[model samples]
Target: MIVADLSSRELRRRLSDDGLYLHSGPFICRIQSVLAKVADGLALAYADYPLADADYADFHLRLAAPRLRRWISPQVQFHADVRQPFLPLPQQQAYAMFEWGLNWCVSQHANQYLILHAAVLEKNGRALVLPGHSGAGKSTLCAGLVYGGGWRLLSDELTLIRPADGLIQALPRPVSLKNASIEVIKQLAPGAIFTPTVMDTSKGSVAHAKPPSDSIVRQQECARLAWVAFPRYRAGAALNTQTVSVPQLLMRLAEQAFNYSLHGQDGFSTLLNWAQSAQAFEFEYSDLPQAIAYFEQLASQPHTQLQHEAAPV
Candidate 1:
């Protein structure tokens, strides 16, 4: 059964008591919380995700609302396997904290694959990996591609690469948008569904866009890496795609990778193979619609020998 099979009351009850175990592509996470907003957020953002059976889980997580803190200023703390791993957030930011906390847990501990701080999306059988620094509009660009550009979402934060085969492991989850990107996506994709916006977090007014139901249903499907684009959002800049050398892509990807060194030769070999097989580019844009159009064209065009400089650091 999926999350939509449960009523809001049932979901809340499950989260408050026995916990809600749900499938997130390759991993199963059991989330427990007393915060009502958490239930609301999950129902909106994860309604398409399957409910995992009680027998197994990769992560056991909880959001605790301490009575003392509630009496004082009202806060929520994130716990992993009964140990608090993060500071308490304002009670209103419980759902955002849960989302961010879960990402932290996976990125820090899941070393079976080479994890990159990036977003991955697919069209046909090829994946487009967006690796960018904070405030680089990676998530924003990803949400647009998924909802408006007819691509499937593989992941919004973590790009898991299987070193053995150089395939992207899908982990379709809600796309987290910060500050202005939330409304930017709303305007770009009118049908996009989002959780309630939480204000004044470390990321500044964070919100989450629900992944397309098609993406969630097909989350188990993996794809070969086809393109790696480092996106930058500059005000009023025209859409531009610059060819990047394989060495440049490797260095940049290593900087953003979570487990590059941990995988040793496997990581090096996989990245080298990936660079050989996939095209790399540095993408900068200001207009969302034009950017979407450019990517669509890029995906459809035939691959050619790139004659250009290395990408910017």
Candidate 2:
């Protein structure tokens, strides 16, 4: 069902409380938490027109960050104070932005364990971990992996790594698709549910592609990270495989880290120990077939050559 179509007067009515609206493309998110479906969304008061010099990420970091904590509580209070009934157009518009910001928090919080920025897929008792940075074609590769490689997408953004065991946790978050990538995925997976596209985000005209039903259904069965493969998408670069230096990986990963210092020396030790057990590689490819074949081969190697992603923070 559609949530509130916010107006200045209606927004003022909710002055006593805050509300959340989730808009993704055509669909309005009816968040189903344990307490309620949040049919209209948890009552959180918001402005008719909030700050927007940047994308939803900036809004989340700036406005919502103050209300949020680095860690959440078990019975966390959601801003629930709505005065008027749900609206249509405006609610959807606001939902589109709020949804992204909240999801970003979920991902960042999960990363408290490890700095995982990749698309993850699991199937047949195996989880394929693709670790990379922005503009690395990680999302596009992920779209290909799930659509062609016959795997379940665990995440398209953050792959939360458990600090103690170095186990890669599956964070079932939405996939962020850019202009062409969105079309590419729709062509590949027609049944994929995509939210509304927000104009002029960091990557330009961004949208969120949701997780597969199979992944959602099996969300409880956490997949143990079997292999960590670093993917790189180069326009004209030939397909090549090179060993990534351990120290180099650590440093790079630390830069992307969300909470490396919070865990202190123990966090470093855990990551290092895990690196010693996994094989590290620099996967560069201009062609998709070679990239796919490369990963297929890595799947065959023994999991004895441990590697690191970013160096010690």
Candidate 3:
């Protein structure tokens, strides 16, 4: 059963009692919370994700208001198993806390696959890996491609690469939007669903856009890596693209990878293989529409033509 199958009351009861086992892509997270915001956020943003059996879950998570603090300051705390990794935040940010906490769970513990702090999207069976630092517009560009440009969302925060085949494992979850980009995305995809923006979070006015139903439906499907682009957003700057050499791409990807050193030599070999197989570029843009159009054109080109046209950096 999908999350949408549950009645609001039942969803809340499950969350407040035995916990809700939510299946998204490869992991099943058992979430327990009494917060109304948590239930509402799941109802809207995670409506399409499957409901897993309670027999087992990859991570056991909880969000609850501290007994005395709730009466005074009203704050929410997130727990992963027995550990609380983050300090409490305002009660209004409960849903945002859940999302961020889950991301922490996967990025910190799911080391079976090489995890990169990047967004991955697919089209025509090929994946585009966008690795960027905070404020780099990676998620903004990813949201545009998925909601506005027809690319399938694999993941917005973590790009999981399976070492066995060098293919990307799909982990299509809600894309987080911050501050001004929230309005920008609303303008880009008016019909897209979003959680209510929680103001004054550490990340600055944070919100999450629900992944498309199609992306959720195809969550089991994986994609072969075809391109790697490091995107930067500079207001009013014209679109610029420069080809990244294999060595440069590997070095950059290593920096972005969360568990690169954990895998030791095997990790280096995996990254080297992927860098050589896919074309890499540094992408800079200002306007979302123009950026989307540029990628759309790139997607339509033959592999040979793309290789010939790429200017070495």
Q: What tens-digit string does per-residue lDDT give for candidate 2 at 1-313?
A: 2223454344333322333233321112222222221222223211111222121221112122112432442122222122112222122233344445445555444444564666777756667777777778888778776665557767777666678777666655456777777887787678766666656554576766655545544544566665556788888999877776656666656655567777788777765665555556777777665566566665556554443355544
Clash number for every model? 0, 30, 0
In Å, residue 156's CA in model 2 sits off its true spot by 1.6
TM-score of 3: 0.96
Worst 10 residues of 1 by lDDT: 304-313
lDDT of 1 by residue, 233-296 (tens): 9999988889888888878888889989999878987887777667889999998888899889
Alpha-carbon RMSD of each model = 3.0, 11.5, 2.9
Candidate 2, position 56, lDDT: 25
| Model 1 TM-score, all chains together | 0.95
Query: With candidate 2 superimposed using the best TM-score fit, by how many Å does residue 267's alpha carbon deviate from the native?
Result: 0.9
| lDDT against the true structure, each candidate | 0.89, 0.53, 0.93
- TM-scores across all candidates? 0.95, 0.64, 0.96
Q: Positional deviation of 137 in candidate 3, in angstroms?
A: 0.7
Best of the two (2, 3) by TM-score: 3
Is candidate 2 or 3 superior in lDDT?
A: 3
